[model samples]
Target chain A: MDTLNYLLQGFGVAFTPLNLALAFAGAFIGTIVGLLPGLGPINGVAILMPIAFAMGLPPESALILLAAVYMGCEYGGRISSILINVPGDAGAIMTAIDGYPMARKGLAGVALSISAWSSFVGGVVATIGLVLFAPLLANWALAFGPAEYFALMVFAIACLGGMVSDRPVKTLLAVLIGLSLACVGVDSNSGVYRFTFNDVHLADGVQFIVVVIGFFSISEILLMLEESSIGQSIIKTTGRKLFNRQEMKETNPSTLASSIGGFFIGVLPGAGATISSAIAYMVTKRVYDKDGSFGKGDIRGVSAPEAANNASATGSFVPMLCLGVPGSGTTTVMMGALALYNITPGPMLFQNQPEIVWGLIASLFVGNVVLLVLNIPLVGFFAKMLTVPNATLVPGIAAASAVGVYSVHATTFDLVLSVAFGVLGYLLRKLQFPMSSLILGFALGDMIEQNLRRALSLSNGEVGILWHSPVSLTLWIGAVAMLVGPPLLRRLRRGRAALAVG
Target chain B: MRAERVFGLVWLAVSAAMAWVALDLKAPISYEPVGPRAVPLLYAGLMAACALTLVLRPHAVAFHWPHGKVVHHIVVSAGLLLGYAFAFEWLGFPLATALLALLLGRVFGGSWRTCASGGVAMGIVLYLFFDRLLDVVLPLGLLQPLFGG
Candidate 1:
């Protein structure tokens, strides 16, 4: 009842004409930026953050605008994934696995609407979870020390090889390569330049945007070139323009479960929508793939990841608001935005600045509703991107790729690096390697290595420290079971069948 | 499978070089308890193992290089893209973008008129939206005088 009262007061602040207008504007721009090739929520927020500050809006309104953009981008990312095989950002990668196939089958509208709906549900649920559990979840998240984090990240990486592909070894190799690439820059702890090759730009290591734009956009451009010799529309736009009752019924359970699971995962510091969505897709595949329909336009496959991605985006805000620990990469930038206002978010924040805290939360609820309303109407327009002829679309993609890659650092070197990664991605793709594991490895490599090192250092270089805690121990045992269980189960089933025949 | 073997050998050489570099990478002093070297060495070691498995097994999946004109298309496209990238800072977003769009549009089977008009519109509209509206700080370069940059 008290929570409801606080929320009502929050609504009082969020419903102000200025805050509401800011919310709509942020959602509008954010969705546009998010659908652009290679740009995502981080870019959306980061780009608009300065404008919000320069306009000198009060901290609460500025925060509301930025948060709306953050949520809007999460919805926007699925548009690119459904229309093109390329993901808008790391979090949307799993959406593309099934979404693109659905688009190819002339269900682009169904994929877009379903994704938008799932994203809204996830964001709303996560915001509710925030209201109820932010403080408690933030405290619990502290229990994840370096060892536990290392174990968890390893388990997440292991999840990829075990399920994402028929060739586990090849998937594992892709991950290993991504991890190695992550090691190229100067080491954060000791400042040792590993594989810099004396290039000043390499001293900072490869940027994630550079790697992503290269690996996805470049490869996509080439693939389109090869397959588009006949220059057909990217996908047909005919068929059901929206998901029907049965389609929604089929996807509801996966979307709901993944939303909840995704929120919890997002509450963990340093884990973001990327890992949450990836895990959600894999888990949903395991639980619901009775027809082996995952990665083949399965509506469940699309909803699961989209829900998790948006839920995780909302969940990330909890740690930032409650504990002042930035939960995800996007929130880290948001933390900087807050710093511009001379605000330090901590336990005292809710008490000290109730309007700021509660208003942001209230705006999340508002922002999500706006996103759903905005996305549903825009579904047809976004889906029509499929009908964009390659003549126009191909060049458009290239220009967008260049803009996206260059805008990150405004450096030509990153642009060149993107092309290089594109070539490598093309080759690996031809060899049947799943790029998702590679991306997951690159994203998580720094986290895993840093945690491992920190945990080891805490124990004075004792390897056993990794599994010493009950949390880490349980996680280790689970990871081992995950790795060893599938093949063993297959053999057991085969043996039982043989025995029955005998 | 034969292509996989060759690719495996390439990966093996790459990992070997990675390990060699990782071995030489050193911290000035022992500031970090585990140091930076160990983690990189671990990556190198694991990569080496995967590369070896590739060399030994080289999955029986056959790999074929793209054929003839498709190969031609790929090479030209890649070359054009790299050229656009290298020339990006010099040519500026608008000019470089126009050239890239025009050429890539042609490669994708657009008529000269369609490619030219489409390319120009894309270059100009994106620049206005991203640069003027969004304040993204793109270089005007040759368009400096025209745009009063």
Candidate 2:
């Protein structure tokens, strides 16, 4: 009953004319950005953030708008994947596997519609999960001491190590690099400068928005330039733009299962939409498709990953809002945005700022509906966005990124820094290093250090106190298990595959 | 594979330098047992370990490098970007942005006419959008004298 009242009040807040308009505009822009190849939600949100701030939007309004964009990107990613076999974002990689095949089989409309509907289902289900589980998680987190927080952070990093990339060591390297970057500027506790290197700009620390825009938007521009495709060929829509009743019926079960799985996976720290969708697709293929038609244009193949990825996208928000820990690179950027508003997301957020929290949740419901409506009747319009030449798009993105970062402080230093990070990001991508872990580590580094110091101070420097409490112990054990589990699971799966093949 | 080794060595040197610098951190009052240096030092050590692993058992994958004209394109694009950054404040948002876009358009295979018009149009539109609508004060530079206060 209490939750119901809060939700109703949230609806009242979200339904206001200004907020509704912002949500619609955010969804529209997010969808367009997401439709562009090599530009995803992270780029969209990061590039737009300074503009949002410069416009003097209320923190809640800005968050609502950005969240809408985040959700819209999930819906928009599948268009390029299905139409041209080119994933618009990382999460849509699996979508292209089956979605493009389906498009080739002349079921482009069926693939697009089914994936859109599946994405809607996943997003809605995850939002419901967010409302129910976030509060409960926040309540539980209230009892966490510094030791527990430190342990939990360690666990989160371990989970990231286990899940984010094919090689855990590479992920760890990325995390360490991020932590090193985070060490720059003046240390708050002791007021000591660490790695400023006598530069005035270094005194304020690297701005999260600059780093995000540099790493995502700038690097993406460079990569697009490297490809240098003047025009991309896209598959034409031969069939109906809407899925048939039979196709809908066929995909329902897979969609539901993927939604559930994806949401759970999303809620876990370090696990994101990419992994969730991959796992959900694999599970769906194993259970539902006995004919082995999954990669060969099976509708369920399109449905499963689409649902899971969207669910996971929503699910990633759980940790960010509830525990103040971001689960992915994108959510980390969002958390950075919240920090700009002087709001730290965690247990106290629920008690203190119900309007912001509940309003965001309510806006998700509205945003997803807007995305579904916008995607179905107008997917063709979005597909046409593919025809946009790389020359104009790449330079345009670079100019926007430059201008956006410059607008923040009007500093030439930040522009230089952004370009530097852009080169670093390009090299990292070339080396197959997972960028998310670096961003996550950077976002969480201060908290982890703070918690570690507090815990040690309280325990009189006894390291054992870190593992003394039951909560801390549980988290430590979870971290250890996460470190050991992935390789074992991989071996087991590989052995099973070998047996099946034999 | 050789690229991985080079990357590993570079990271190793970076971590070592980080740890060395961390040793110089001076905290006046010790309110906590672990000071700011501990975390960075720890990260540096872990990163060293990872880099060592990469050096020892680097993944066997080919690193693709751009060739000939593609390399030229990448270098030119990067140069254009850097030039844009250097010229951003001095040339103002509109002119610098327009020039960069024009060059990039030509590099991206656009006809000279299309590139010229597109660059100027996009620059003006973006300037109007950011400066007028969003209230962001983009640097007008040389254009300021022409527009007048």
Candidate 3:
């Protein structure tokens, strides 16, 4: 009864004229951005975030809008995958396997429709998971102490190391770089300025928004510029409809199974949408065994990955809201946004800011609906957005970015900082380092520092205090698991190699 | 391999520098045993170790540079950003933003005609959005005489 009442309040808040309009606009723009090649959810969310923040919407409303955009992108990305055989995001790669084949068979419209519907079903189901699980997890986290939070942060950073394709050493080094960048301002606790170099702007620390825009947005722009003419040109449509009822029925079981799998995977600390989608594709192939038609214009194959991808996207938010740990790059960016609002997203959030928490949760339900509605009817229109030349797109993106940053401080210093980050972002991307981990580290740095300090203060400097409580002990174990698990897995790989060589 | 080594060496040097700096700091508090400096130093040491591994591995990983035109695009984009910074400070937000948008849009591929028209429209919408809707204070710059911002 209490939950229902709160949810009702949440809907009341979400239904306001301003919030509704923002949700619609966010969904619309998100679809267009998602349909564009090379700018996946991480870049798309980061690019639009500055503008949303500049609009100065309250945190809940901002979250609502951003969440809507994210959900919308998950839906819109499939259009390109099916039509052009180009996965708009990495998670969509599996979608491309059968999607393009279906398109080639002139069932593009049917494939797209089923993809959108499955996505909607996955989203709705995941939102149901969010409603039921987030609060319970948040309540459990309420028992955590400062030492536990410190341990959790350690676990999060370690998970980041374990998850990326690069060596754990490199990922940790990248995280340290992000942390060091975070420390380049006034010390929040001691108030002794650290690494500001006498620059007024550094006193506030590097804005994560600026870093996000620079690394993800600017770097992407640079990379896209390089590929200016390499990729396929805008695909011409043959006015073909999508999958039929029989095709949808064939895909139904795989879609349902994958969504369930995706949600479970997404709830884990390090496993997110990309892995879920990959696993879904494998599972669909293994279970259905359609004589290798799986990857070749099989509607079931396309549906499985698309459903799982979007479901995992929704599921990844669970840990962030409940445990203050992000499961993937996109949610890591969302964490950055929450930090900007001075809102910490762990157990205390549920206690201290129930309205914000529930409001965000409620808005997501609305956002997903808005996304499906916006995406389904406007799929062709968004596909047309792909036809816009990069020449026009790049500059307009830059302008919006410039205007957004200026709106924040009205200072040229911020703009300069943004551009510098852009260059840094470009370099990082070129090296194939995970950009999202840097954002995560930067976002979590202050909280981790504060918690570490608090834990030490209470324990009178005894390092043992970190392991004193059960919660802290468990979290420490988890952190150890995160750090040690990957190397162990790597050792297995090496063992296999040695056995083969022998 | 070259890129990884470059990044690794830089990381190592930076971590070493951070360690040195951490040593110079006052501990979290005088009585605090573990000390504020310990974790940071630990992190720095860990970073240095990782950096050393990168440098030691020393593989010439595939280095793919963007084409020359793309390089030009990146450089020009960066330059445009720098220009926007200075221009906004001197000319004010609305005027600077409009002019920057106009120039960048044109360079990116917009027609001169569309650039001029779209620039004004975008400028006005931004003004109303920020100034009127959000009550954010934007620089009027010389536009103080015309729009009286």
Q: Interface root-mean-square deviation for each candidate?
A: 2.5, 1.4, 2.9
* Docking quality (DockQ) for each candidate: 0.59, 0.75, 0.46
Which order, best to worst by DockQ? 2, 1, 3
Q: After best superposition, candidate 3 residue A438: deviation in angstroms?
A: 0.5
Give residue B95's lDDT in candidate 1 (0 to 100): 87
- For model 2 the local lDDT of residue A289 reads 82
Winner on lDDT between 1 and 2 is 2
lDDT tens readout by residue for model 3, B1-149 = 88888888887888888888877766345654544566578778888888898899965555577677667767886787778777776887777777766776665666888777777776677777766776655677878888782
For candidate 3, write residues A1-502 as lDDT tens digits: 7778778888888888888887888777777777777777877677666566766778888888878888877887888898888887777888888889888887777778888888877887887888888888888888888898888888878777777655677677677777777776777666656666778887888777677777776667666666644346545545655556787778888899888888877887666677888999999899997587877788788888888888888888888888887877788888877876877777777778777778877777888788767666667787777777665567566666666666656678887887788888788777776776777777777777878888989988777988889878887788788878878988999999999999
**Alpha carbon lDDT of residue B36, candidate 3?**
50
Candidate with top TM-score is 2
Model 2, chain A: how large is the TM-score?
0.97
Off by over 4 Å in 2: A492-502
Q: What is the lDDT of candidate 1?
A: 0.80
The lDDT leader among the candidates is 2
